[model samples]
Target chain A: MLNIKDLHVKLEEEDKVILKGVDLDVPAGAVHAIMGPNGSGKSTLSYVLSGRDGYEVTAGAATLDGADLLVLDPEERASAGLFLAFQYPVEIPGVGNMTFLRTALNAQKKARGEDEVSAGDFLKLIREKAKSLKIDADMLKRPVNVGFSGGEKKRNEILQMAMLEPKMCILDETDSGLDVDAMRLVSEGVNALRDAGRSFLVITHYQRLLDHIKPDVVHIMANGRIVKTGGPELALEVENNGYADILEEVA
Target chain B: MGLPADKSDATADRLAALTMPDGASWARIAREAASTRFQAMGLPGRRDEYWRFTQPDTLNAIQPPEAALYPPEDPPAFSALDRLSVVFRDGIFDPEASDDLALEGLEIERLSTATQADFHWAKDLYGVLETRGQDPVERPFAALNTAFATDGVVLRATKKILKPIHFRYLHEKTDSDAILHFVVRVEEGAELTLLEGGPAAARFNKCMEIDVADRGSFHHIRAQGRDHERRAVTHLFARLGEESTFKSFTLTANGRLTRNEAVIELTGDNATAHIAGAAVGDGDFHHDDTVFVTHDAVNCESRQVFKKVLKNGAVGAFQGKILVKEGAQKTDGYQISQSLLLDEDAQFLAKPELEIYADDVICSHGSTTGAIDEEALFYLRSRGVSASEAQDLLVLAFLAEAIEEIESEEIADDILTRLESWLVRHRG
Candidate 1:
């Protein structure tokens, strides 16, 4: 459902290259994970795909279901069913979490020319989703992630993913700051949203997250390129021996 | 051979040209004293310390651009509240449109109808609070308002009133110039809530003096209307007794020039006062808020929260101070003024000062002016909210801090609706 070909990106303000000749493809209904050591351009790829500013796409083409994703604004891309779960969720003070969700939902509806959900229906829907994520009413009543713990913030992101129901989901280091319990709850939430028509690109440094939400394929990235691609066992291999053998094999 | 340069005071020349209203009421002596005080002080000059950030030209002009009273479209603010309404058209009290002047345990009398034989509760209050508020600095317009204002209301609350008193000022004359003065007294253990709304005239000068006795409570909410060519200069003087509570919130939409100054004195121990303003401005809009609070009694608390949103070269200014006397121990005072500039041309100037002479007191003040948070903006936009929608959300969030100071939820909601509609109109 998502495709990229020879994507080259560099920092806009500085003469620094982040991604050099990277290419990947995630087919419909498939789950893929990208694992690499530090500074391997995994998060950079996610940000460039999400149309974040401060990045110059030197050479590349990215399309979602054959529709040009780079041409659309971030919000337009969101309406076109591209979702990126941020690694560090922003803290917005004085904006209630529920209000934010409602505004977002109605905004998307207006863009899609669909009937907006009533307040009562929205309350019920949010409550149902929040209960599954173990979020209480107080969390929804407070400002969006203002003082939320790291785990709470991650869980909130998963809750947003559940509510948006995008066709393709990109999770950037969702397991970075999570503990064992939080990781399991988050993986369970992701697993609950698994469907035959949906796809996920899980980017992480550890193999523990893949244990819960098992990926159909695993790719090893190093020096701005996906150097190795294999079945799920590649993740366990990297987890066991690290990226030493993989880098040497690619070399 | 050089010609002599003109040395006449520009400030005095501006005030001398305007004629004072004719009055021979019981406040004649107070009026004369204030007239003399104004003559000495004259109009505020551009070089004045308090008027440094904001120019005093538009406010000092003898003839304001005649603003044709725009047709009223929206319902008056606080219409849903159960209130006793008093209407004013072009600064003149309209007896027919107003409600029956009656309230339980409260006395309401018009200054025009008050008789000399039966001097209302305002006899001592005509200019007493204004005179007391004048200290190191002079407010000549407030003195001028005292000297010439002929139409207003005197309110006295003996007990807890069931409903609030609403004063709706309507503009119907293009060249209307109004000077309004209002006095209110809340007795011991009594409660009062006052609400004022409207764009009164092209050039409006208003003063409200409030005195709350021990253990009394007073809540005020004002909504300054949108009139692009209108210029207004207003003053609020309040004194709180022991254990009293006072909170005032103002919502300013838009105007050519507006300067709202507030002076509050905490006279008795354990009294609390809060003053807040939330303003929105577009092109050709200039809004200023100046507040001074004095903690004269021990264990008193005062807070000032002001927020402004300026766009398209609009200007906003704030000058606020908190002073704690030597014996006012354990005083807790907090003040914060913030502004959101939508673009590079918009300007916000703030001066926050704290003067504490007490050995043990907690007084803190802060001021900030900045654009909307980029990270927060992107966060919302990434969630499918449009760019303008995200901006509106952030603007509202920025204003929520000051809007929360309103004591009534319903009134706050009404103001929020008005702000939303205003944003929609300006987005065009």
Candidate 2:
């Protein structure tokens, strides 16, 4: 359901290329985990897909189900069913968490030509969804991630994803700052949303996270390109031997 | 070089023609004293330090501009709260429109209605506090207000007041010049709240002198209405007794030119005071806030918070100062002035000053002028909110810091709602 062919990206301010000749495809109803070392253009791919500023796509094409994603604005991209769970969630002070969520959910709904969710309905749904994720009423009431723990921020991202329910979800280093318990809670939150229609692209360095949310296909990414595509066993190889052996063999 | 300039003297001639408050008592003497003071000071000039950032010509106009009275878009700011309403139309008291001039635990009398015996206590107060504010700096307009103002209220609180004294200044006539003075005295252990709102006139010069006795509390909140063509200059002078509490907050919307000044002195040990302002201007608008606060007694605290939002070439200025006197040890003073310019054309100018003589005091002041935070804007937009919606949220957040200084949550919420509507209307 997601496609990137010969995708090339670079920083807009400086002449630095981050992505070069990268090609990847994730089929519907499957989970794909990409393992790579530092500077593999993994985070760049996520930012470019989500339409962040300060990045320019130089060549090639990236699309979702035949729709060109490059031309749409970030909000439009979100409405068109693309979600990026940022590695570091932004802190918006003075904007209440509940108010932010309702505003965002209704905005996306209006963009999709659907009925706006009433405040009462939003509160009930958020409460139910947050309960399973271990989010309390106080956390939901505070300003959006203003003084939240790393785990709380991750849980909030998952809450937003569940609320928006986008078809294509990309988790960029969601496991970076999470502890074992927090990781378990986050993985469970993501796993509960897994279905035959929704696809996932999980970009992480460690295979430990893969144990909790198992990926159907594993890809080794290096030098801004997918060097090899394998099954779950590839994650084991990288976890046990580290990417040193694979880098040498590819070189 | 400028051909023996006498432009400033012309305003002095205009003030000479206006009638002064009449009486054979101390009130009249106060007016005569203020008249002499104003005649010497004339009007503030561009070269003067106080009027540096703001234009002084409009305030010195020989005649009030022939402005059409703005049709108000919102009702009086404090209408939702319970209050004793006093109405002024064209700067004249409207008995028919106002409630009966009676409130428990408080004595209210019109300035014009006071007779020889009735003016006994008020005569001592009419311009007493105003003269005290002129030391270290001169406010020619406030002295002018004191010298000529013939209409206002003499209010005194003897005990805890049950309801706020609300003054609704209604503008009905165009090109009207209004000079108003209000004198308030809160006695020992008493409490009082005073609320003022609306555009009083096309050209308005107003001053209020307040005295809070030992252990008394006084609260003042004002909403300067949206009248882009109106020119107004106002001042508030206050003195606090030992252990007294004083707080004042103001909200200003659109106006052609507005200069609001407050001079406060905390004399009583352990007294606390806070003065805050939140103003929003868009298109041909100019608003100024000049505040000076003094701590004269030990262990007293004071705060000054001012925020402004300007857009579409609107201009805003803030000049605030906090002073701690010698031997006023353990004093706490905090002051901040900030402006959120919506675009490049809008501008904000600020001068924040702190004069502290006390060796053991905590005094801090800050000033900032900036556009909206792009990262925060993007964060909101990335969640699917429209650009305009995201900006509105950030603007409200910027103003919320100053609005929080208001003591009453209900009134604060009301003001917030008004700001939201203002933002929506100004969004292009």
Candidate 3:
């Protein structure tokens, strides 16, 4: 569902290369996990794929469902079935959570030439989704992420992912701020959305999250390139021994 | 001290073009007093401390600069509400378009006719609050409005009023210059809501003086008209009694120049006053809000909130002050002024002040001018919102605090709808 070919990205404001000759592919219905140390270009990969500003894709290409994603605007990419669950959800002071969700859903629908959802139907759907995520009505009514706890923010992100139902989902460090209970809840939410037509690229540092989501494959990333690709046991291998041995062997 | 030569000359030139309307002996006396005060202070100049951020040239000129009239496209504001409509066309009362001048729990009349009576309730408040507001700082334009206003409404509420009174000013002539003064008295235990909208003229000057008796309440919501070339200067002076409450909110969009000044005095213990405004401006637009609140009695509270959205080199300015007099213990005052600049060329200038003579008081003021948050923008766009739609949402969010000051949800929604349309129309 998602493909990257020799992806090279550099910071726009300075002369520094963050992602150098990185390539990865996640087929439909499969979950792939990428484990890397800090500053290893894990988050940069997600940002570049999502078409965020301040980054120049110098040399390679990324595509979702066989459509070029690099040339699309961030919103256009969203309409083309790409979603990124941010590591840190932004706190918008006055935009209500429900309103934001509805606007985003309708915008994507309009861009894709689909019928816009009515307010009543949208409300019903959101209430049902929020119930499973344990997000009460008050949280939905409040300003987006304002004064929300870390768990609540992650849950909110999952709620959005569920609502949008994109084809290729990028979870960039979604487990960074979660406790054990929060991680369980978030993983449950993600696991429930797994289907044959959807794909996920789970980016994390630890194997704890992989235990709940059960990735189909694991790739150990080092210095912006995938140094190793293995099964679920690779996550446990890194957990027990750490990245030092893997880095030495790869070198 | 004698007025400066240039100031006196400018004031005289402007006054020479206006003729005060005839009225009763008391009204004449009040106008004469105001005229004397105006001559002493003269028209504000750039050298004045309060006018430093905003140029007073067009506002002080002898002949108003001609403005091209904008075609009215949207329905008039507050049209959905059941109200007592008072319509004015180019400063003159349009009796044909206005409803009957009668309502329960209130006495209302035209200022031109009301002041002609030898004895009237409006006599006590015609220029009383404006004159009292002149001390410590001079507002010569308000004095000028009192001396030479053409026409307006006079209202006195003796009981709780269920329906609001709507003042709809329609601009039809390009060179029409208008000056209007309104006097309001809310008696003890009474309440009233006043709604105003539309572009009055090419150049407009308005003054409203309100005196709220003990336990009385007054609410004001005004939308300055969407005339791209219009110029207006307005003043609101209010005095509150014990346990009285006063709240006023304004929405301004699309004007060449506008200066809205509010002076409020909490004269009795436990009184509360709040003044707020939201303004949106595009190219060639300049909006200013100057506010002053004085706490004279113990435990009085006052709040001032103002927000502006400017783009395409538009300019916005705010000058707000809160003063707690000696013996006014436990005074609580809060003031905040903020502006969102959409482009590098747009500018926001603010001055916030607090003066406390009483030691036991909580007073705080803040002012900020910033651009849109890029991270927030990216977040919204990544979720499928277009760049323009995301910006409009953020702009509305920035102005939400001031819009929330309106007590009525229905009215606030109306203002929000108007703001949304303004954003869509002004989209780059």
Specify the highest-TM-score model's number: 3
lDDT of 1 by residue, B312-408 (tens): 9899999999989889999999999999999998999999999989989988899999999988888898889988889999999999999999878
Pairs clashing within candidate 2: none
The predictions' CA RMSDs to the true structure, in order, are 2.6, 2.7, 0.9
Candidate 2 residue spans exceeding 4 A from truth? A244-251, B1-8, B115-118
Each prediction's total of clashing residue pairs, residues at least 3 apart in sequence or on different chains, is: 0, 0, 0
lDDT of each: 0.89, 0.88, 0.94
Give all TM-scores, in the order shown. Answer: 0.96, 0.94, 0.99
Least well predicted 10-residue stretch by lDDT in candidate 3 chain B:
B67-76
- Looking at candidate 3 chain A, the ten consecutive residues that score lowest on lDDT are A219-228
Per residue, candidate 1 scores C-alpha lDDT tens digits across A105-209 of 888888888899999999999999999999999999999998999999999999998888888899999998999999999999999998888999999999999
lDDT tens string, model 3, A1-251?
99999999999999899998888999999999999889999999999999899999999889998999999999999999999999999999999999999999999999999999999999999999999999999999999999999999999999999999899999998998899999999999999999999999999999999999999999998898888999999999999999999999999
> What are the chain A TM-scores of the candidates, in order?
0.98, 0.98, 0.99
- Clashing residue pairs in candidate 3 (N, C-alpha, C atoms within 3 angstroms): none
Task: Output the number of the DockQ-best candidate.
Answer: 3
DockQ of 3: 0.92
Model 3: iRMSD?
Answer: 0.4
Candidate 2 TM-score over all chains jointly: 0.94
Candidate 1: stretches off by over 4 Å: B1-19, B22-25, B115-118
DockQ versus reference, model 2: 0.67
Question: Poorest 10 consecutive residues of model 1 chain B by lDDT?
Answer: B1-10
- What TM-score does chain B of candidate 1 reach? 0.95
